[model samples]
Target chain A: AQSVTQLDSHVSVSEGTPVLLRCNYSSSYSPSLFWYVQHPNKGLQLLLKYTSAATLVKGINGFEAEFKKSETSFHLTKPSAHMSDAAEYFCVVSDRVLTGGGNKLTFGTGTQLKVEL
Target chain B: GAGVSQTPSNKVTEKGKYVELRCDPISGHTALYWYRQSLGQGPEFLIYFQGTGAADDSGLPNDRFFAVRPEGSVSTLKIQRTERGDSAVYLCASTPGGSRTQYTDTQYFGPGTRLTVL
Candidate 1:
């Protein structure tokens, strides 16, 4: 079984300040982690994914996340927040390919990022 | 190049009514998945298909929900005896399928169908 937890339900940040959205996950096997953003009335867009490669994974829109096995966390971060960054973000996890191909994803409750100008 | 597309952007039905949600995946993608997101929650897996066969369906809540991808492209999710608790955003996603890359391939998602069961 796999599950994810986004520590924050909502996060407010100034436009030029750093953005941090915390996520933690648990899985019986090695897991693949992902960050996805959803704009209002838009599709869920993939931001980044960590698949047991480099611990630091960079994604679109100046976003990135680091996988910490010791902490069971994959927290997303950005250097600066933009007004366009206001959206609901999800932290997702999946088991390794050995488990039913690992296509079934388990998602966190999500963090709503509010970037203030 | 097109992303995933879903039909009936909004659906409202009374209790016990049957509803079907449709999804059209990106061209050439061979994997399709169904997920449901309740208000204030992230999407939860429902089922997945590789080609025309359902590879995993353990996430389905119960027998009331069923999904099909007969031609390996277009898929539909059917809900029977809908209840208010069943109302939520039904999401569809797809990814390119290959034994080597299936685990790491990104899953592209559709805008979703908002189903409201009253």
Candidate 2:
């Protein structure tokens, strides 16, 4: 079984300050991890993803996450938080590879990032 | 290019009624997914379709909840004897599949349909 746990339910940070949202996982196989953002009344947008190739993944809007196997974590980080970064963030994990073209995702509960000015 | 699209952005219905939600995935995308998000929670996978066939339907909550992708590009999630527990924002996502890498199947989500079962 594979599962993802986000450490924080809500995180508040001032604009221009650093941001960190923590996530840990339990997967039998090496996992495919991703971060997604959702604004109020909007759809989810992929922030970044970690496949087998990369450990440190950079995403749009200056957000990034490191896939650390030792820590059992893939924590999203941004050097400078923007007001626009305020939204609900989700950390996701995929259970298995596609026998042919498998691309399934299981999501964590989510963290609400509140950026204050 | 246009992203995935779902119809009837909001639907309010009485309990015990039947409702259908629709999705039109990205052009040329071979894989589509349906998920439901309740208040204050992450989206839960309902089902996923590969091409015109359902590759997985295990996530569906109960027999009353069903989905179909008959022609491959479009899908409909049907709920029979709708329950109040079914009220939530139903999301649709699609990926251009053919590989296992997340890049090959990075899901593009639609705005979602807000279904209210009263």
Candidate 3:
């Protein structure tokens, strides 16, 4: 079984400041993590993913995340927050199924980021 | 290339009625998935299809929920006896298949269909 927990339900940050969204996951097998963002009335977009390659994964839109096995965390971070960054972000996890041979994503409750100008 | 697309961005149905949501995955994507997101909650997996067969359906909530990928490219989620509790955002995603390490492949998602049961 696998699951994800996003520590913060809501976070507010001013423009040009650092942004942080915390996420923790649990899995029986090797886990693959991802961060997805959804704008108002828009589709969910992939921000980044960690697939056991590099601990530090870089993604589009100046966002990145670090996978810490010891901590069981994959927190998203950005050096500077943009006005357009305000959205709902979800942290997801996937593991190889033993019988199905497919990957099913387990998502976190999500964190709503509010960027202030 | 075209991304995943879902038909009827918004759907409204009366209680006990039946509804079908359609999903068209990206060209050449062999794997398709269905998920549901309730208000203020994350998306929960419903089912997965590899080619024309259902690879995993363990996430389906009940017998009322069913999905199929007859052509292996287009998929549909059918709900029978829809209830108020069943109203939520139904999301569809797809990933490129044939990867030796399938877990590493990224899944592209669609805008989702908002089902409102009244």
| Poorest 10 consecutive residues by lDDT, candidate 1 chain B | B96-105
TM-score of 2: 0.96
Clashes of 3: 0
Cα deviation of B46 in candidate 1 (Å)?
Answer: 0.5
Weakest 10 consecutive residues of candidate 2 chain A by summed lDDT:
A95-104
TM-score of 3: 0.97
Question: Using lDDT as the measure, what is the rank order of every candidate, best first?
Answer: 3, 1, 2
Candidate number of the best lDDT:
3
Best-to-worst DockQ order: 3, 1, 2
lDDT per residue (tens digit) for residues A10-115 in model 3? 9999999999999999998899999999997788899999988999999999999999999999999999999999999999999855234667889999999999
Candidates sorted by TM-score, descending order? 3, 1, 2
Per-prediction interface RMSD?
2.2, 2.5, 1.6
Q: Which stretches of model 2 miss by more than 4 angstroms?
A: A98-100, B100-104
Model 3: runs farther than 4 Å from truth? none
Cα displacement (angstroms), candidate 2, residue A72, comes to 0.5
Following a full C-alpha superposition, what root-mean-square deviation does model 2 have from the true structure?
A: 1.5
The models' CA-based lDDT, in order, is: 0.92, 0.90, 0.93
Task: Give the C-alpha miss distance for residue A94 in model 3, angstroms.
Answer: 1.1
